[model samples]
Target: MNLHSPSSTVADADLQERGGAPATWLPAVAEGLDIRRIFVAFRRRFRLFAAVALAVLLAVILVTLQATPKYTATANVMLDTRKERVSNVEEVLSGLPADSSAVDTEVEILKSRQLAERVVKGLKLEEDPEFNAAVRKPSGVKMLLGGIASLVGAKAPNLPQANSVEAQKLHEEVVDAVLDGLSVKRAGLTYVINVNYESDSPTKAAIIANKFAELYLLEQMEAKFDATQQATTWLNSRLGELRGQVQTDEAAVQQYKIANNLLSASGTNLTEQEISNYNLTLSQARAQVAEDQARLSTARSQLSRGSSGDDVGEALSSPVVQKLREQRAAVSAQVADLQGRYGERHPEMLKAKRQLSDIDTQIQDEIQRIISNLQAKAQVSSQRAAAVSGSLGGARGTLAANSRAMVRLNELQRNADASRTLYESYLNRYKETSTQGGLEQSDARVVSKAKIPTSQSSPKVALNLALGLVLAVGAGIGAVLLAEMLDAGLATAEDVERRLDTSYLGAIPLLASVAEGRTEAPIDYVMAKPLSSFSEAFRNLRTSVLYSRLGEPVKVVAITSALPGEGKTTTSICLARSAALQGAKVLVVDCDLRRRTVNRMLEAEPEIGLLEVLNGEATLEQTITLDAPSGAYILPLSKSNFTPKDVFGSVAMDKLLADLRQRYDLVILDTAPVLPVADTRVLAPKADVVVFLARWRKTPQHAIEAAFRLLSGTGAHVGGVALTQMDMKQQTKYGYGDPGYYYAEYKKYYVS
Candidate 1:
């Protein structure tokens, strides 16, 4: 709540850490915004807000009326991607939103200086008077000063002649003005941009709008062509390399097959046949070898048993030869294999048996052929191996030679494969690049053409007016608040209470007749509306004075204030008159001996009075005189030959007051302002109540405090203050306009 730190116990951070709620102010603002309260408050200040608003509106309307008419022409523009889509409309913008980064790019282009310059040059507005005036203020000031000196004091010194520069400068100014006048913006999410500009010439408006469109469209086209040209150059370079790579890869594939003797076999057709034939031959040879080993094993067994080992049955007994022998045996494995799955008498089983017989016969024939070939070739190989073994002395030498040849062939194959893979990949990329290079982008096309605009987009008249209104209202309210803040005067009823430190007596309205500009009878309120101001204010004061202590009576009342011009004298006279009207014999005293103004107020006869008696020259009744009204008695200051302080301080003065008190029901004394004179301080010892007056908006606050300090021990009870000259505007600012409110209620009795 406190923006500043207090010197005593409180701290700024502690107050802040109270953790104000974000919405806490809402309830308070809402409560203060009560319809009646807000209305009343506004009504009180209605003159102020209305005055401000009227001034602002009138100023705006006058200025706008005098303003040169500016007609705006606008053109719509839609952006085009400027290139066909690559294969699919969705591909280039795949999963992208409609508001692409490119859209912003175009917006920036429209606002770019390059485009602005183009518009400026096209419009040739730099030479225009209005724009030249705005831009040439510096030069104008120099010219004006020089011209002034030329006229009044001395002949102008010769200045440099710049006719050419001035003409060129004027041309440049025209272009800059055009640029300033133009405004381009994308209206919203749409592809359309609104190109608007303002000009005094209607034909020029349309012309500028059209020119901007042409320039922007041309710029976009040029940009597209430039980008495409660069891309084509790069793509062509890549494409050439790709073409050579693809050819190289094709050649490598062909060459690898020829060198490896795999041309036919590696090809799809021959490869399939070779795979089938190799498997068949390997199966047949394996069967024959197994049969031969089985037969040889049988023969060995026969030989060991002293039977004819050369017998065919011996081949079946040789396990190694038996497998081979069984392939060509009378007993067939094919028949057994089928017999386990099917009945032997079945047609399929019978056919398998016949096929097995044929296979056995073929295997036997093949084994015989191998045996015969081995008999001869094996003899030759053995002879050669024996010969080589004798020279090298190891079989490993022959094995090493064969391993080296095979390793060399495998290395060739690996190299060929690597080259082929590399070449093929390059070729594929080249083809793809070429194909893509030909593809076009579609989908994003300009729906509208770019155009020069004729209207500027800023300094909206309505908006400026609204803003001015707001600013004026703020300034007016601030002025009122500043007035309140700097107020060094009596502020309110509460301030009067605090200064006086006494029970509230009541209040009287400041009248034109009472102060400022005129002097009239103090009983004016009583003569006109006695019940409102005079009768009401006095009756309330009397009741408060009587009931303050809840005592049986109050006989003597004293009136004083912190300073002069607080209306203390006036109040004393009025109080006595009111009491006298109620049939009470009241004696009013001019007890302020040092500054006696009241004695002159009643037009009392200059004769022996209170000072005379206090000096022991005259007795109490001899000095006291009856007033214009018989029920009231006036005791004024006697023209003492000396200062009357000694007289009033004497015991005889006290006896005179006692005697007057018994004669009159009520005695009112008008004393000196407490702070200015010691007489009131001295006389306070005998008074019952001290009535202090604080003139509103006039009496400084510190003066009242000083008054209380001066009269602290005075016998009189400190009575409340009578605030004078209340401000109507203040009542409005503080929301005191309503009848039920305090200001209104008090006004009814005090000011009405």
Candidate 2:
């Protein structure tokens, strides 16, 4: 079938547009994953991957074997909210709180340089070579570097020497070393803090860990004790000042009292006492005067009314009046008996009446005397009351004068009381704090003491090996990808068409497979294995060349490559043989006069070759030889160093091609590589179809593109590209996108 017929050409164009070259590349790139491509790339560069992976794994192994094993020991210290209480008094320094923040603070304290220094000094770590750099031996690498530096006369950097410096510097270095090995962290939002230390020796790790815990507790205790002591001292000093103030204020009160004559008696001043006494006395006197005046007025009222003093209460109760009344009663009784016995005007009756009258007079006299006594007592009481009132008035006047002086005294007394209260308060606090100094305790305690570790914590063999394996895999993958990116060669049919933007004719299998242990040239092998894949590929190439253009047939075909050893001569001869076997007359002309590889390939040592024919030394008929196996004509060159300028592009060469085109159905020129020689570039434009050849998986695409660019510049119709030396056995591994992908499965169709 003519591949270049209108229907076939349109079909090819549609196939390519739908899923040919563009499909091969787009699916690999746009989809972002092509497993077959990856497999092929890996297969091609597996050696590089292996080398990188092995090197990385070996380095890891060496480091793991040489590393010094370290042991870790941990001790737990918890922030204790519960502490033993000796007294009800509050502490000068409070205990640590049981919160995450508090635990974090304690963790920081454990990591502090202060505690680290304490541990270093307590454990005498400055003498240990593990911590003291000056005492430690130099490592092998460092010694080698030092030796190199000395040989080169390079001065070492000046660093502080621990032995030469002060003891403080050495201690500081040891502290820093201890801190570096120590890991203090709060255990997951808990009040318990973990104190971990790493060291070469298990015992050393345990000892350091325990030391940190012990020192941390001790630090807490000391801080509390110091705070208590400081509080006690301050209180003691303040108490002394307050005591002096109290004494001074009390003295001032006393002095003010003395100056003001405001001395107190029975919790009151003298004037106040006097005022109270006078108030009582005046009240009593006023009562007495009122009583006396009432008595005196009653007596005078009775006298003015012409009534006897018998109505007076004092007169009525008089003992003499009572006696007179009894005697009068007796007289009256005698008078009544006599009157009854005798008539009127009896002497005894008159005597009895007279006796009663005398008794009554006596009573009157007694009542009047009582009235006089009452009046005298009333006047005496009034005079005594007036005297008491005068004395009370004088005392009240003195009290008013003293009340004005008491104000200043009261202020002084208040000042004294405040000072005394303050002094007592300080004294009490001083006593409490002084007792607290000896009773201080730490806020934290060790919950778990560090024990000597039995197993090493570092240089874990299994873990290191796992990590090494992962790193090796990563490095291998990276190296493979890098090699793929750096490669510029074309391997498959898809690569030729997609990268070069040209038609892909076919892939020619390696000659060895077609020969199949038969000793024959490539052209003879093609003739011997006519049904083989090698011969089939050449027939496909011939069809593509003959039908590349619909209007005119491709009679003159040029076979060339970017570089030598690309199977260009074999392709030319095989293409000619394939056409000749198809019942068409074909001739192959070796245009490379410099190397003359076709003569060697064809075993033709003609005395008259293309050089002789073009230089007019011989005729074309004399120079031409026949490949008897395939019935193809060959015009090979003899071994020579003579190369003429523009020989292939000369008029004689054009005429020879024209004559061959007229006589033969097809004429093929096996030309030199385009990049190395100018013969192929000048000769390629004369052919109707130029088949650019590349070695499968061997020739770089940049070389092919460069050669194609030169050929196109010479106005050559480069029909397509074909890959020679294709490995059929390995081609299946490249997957379905490649031309020889099914070469293995289709081997049953071949007779070879």
Query: Considering every candidate listed, which one attains the maximal lDDT?
Result: 2
**Candidate 2: Cα lDDT at 14:** 62
**Steric clash pairs (candidate 2):** none
Cα lDDT tens digits for candidate 2, 1-752: 11134563464456445432222323476668877776766776688889999999999999999999999999999887888988988888888766677777778888999888888889989889999985778899988986886665434343334324655777787888888889998888777889999999999999999999999999988898888888888887788788889989999998987886667723436767777887898788889878988988889898899987778888778778888888888888888899999845988878888888998899888987887887898898889888888888888777666466776777889999999988888887787787775788778889999999999998998999999999998999998766655555566776765566678888898877545676777778777778877789998888777777668978898898999999888888888888888888889888877878777876667766878888888898888888887788888886663676778768998888888989888888888899999888788889898888888877876677568667766878888888888877767754356758777777778777
Best by TM-score: 2
TM-score of each model, in listed order: 0.52, 0.59
lDDT of 1 by residue, 65-180 (tens): 57776767777777643444445322211221356576676667766668766776666555445556534455867889867865754442433344456656766666676766
How much lDDT does each candidate structure score? Answer: 0.59, 0.80
Candidate 2: C-alpha lDDT: 0.80
lDDT of 1 at 477: 64
* Worst ten in a row by lDDT for model 2: 18-27
Poorly placed runs, candidate 1 (over 4 Å): 1-50, 79-82, 85-109, 127-176, 190-192, 217-446, 449-503, 509-520, 523-536, 605-622, 639-664, 674-686, 695-716, 723-752
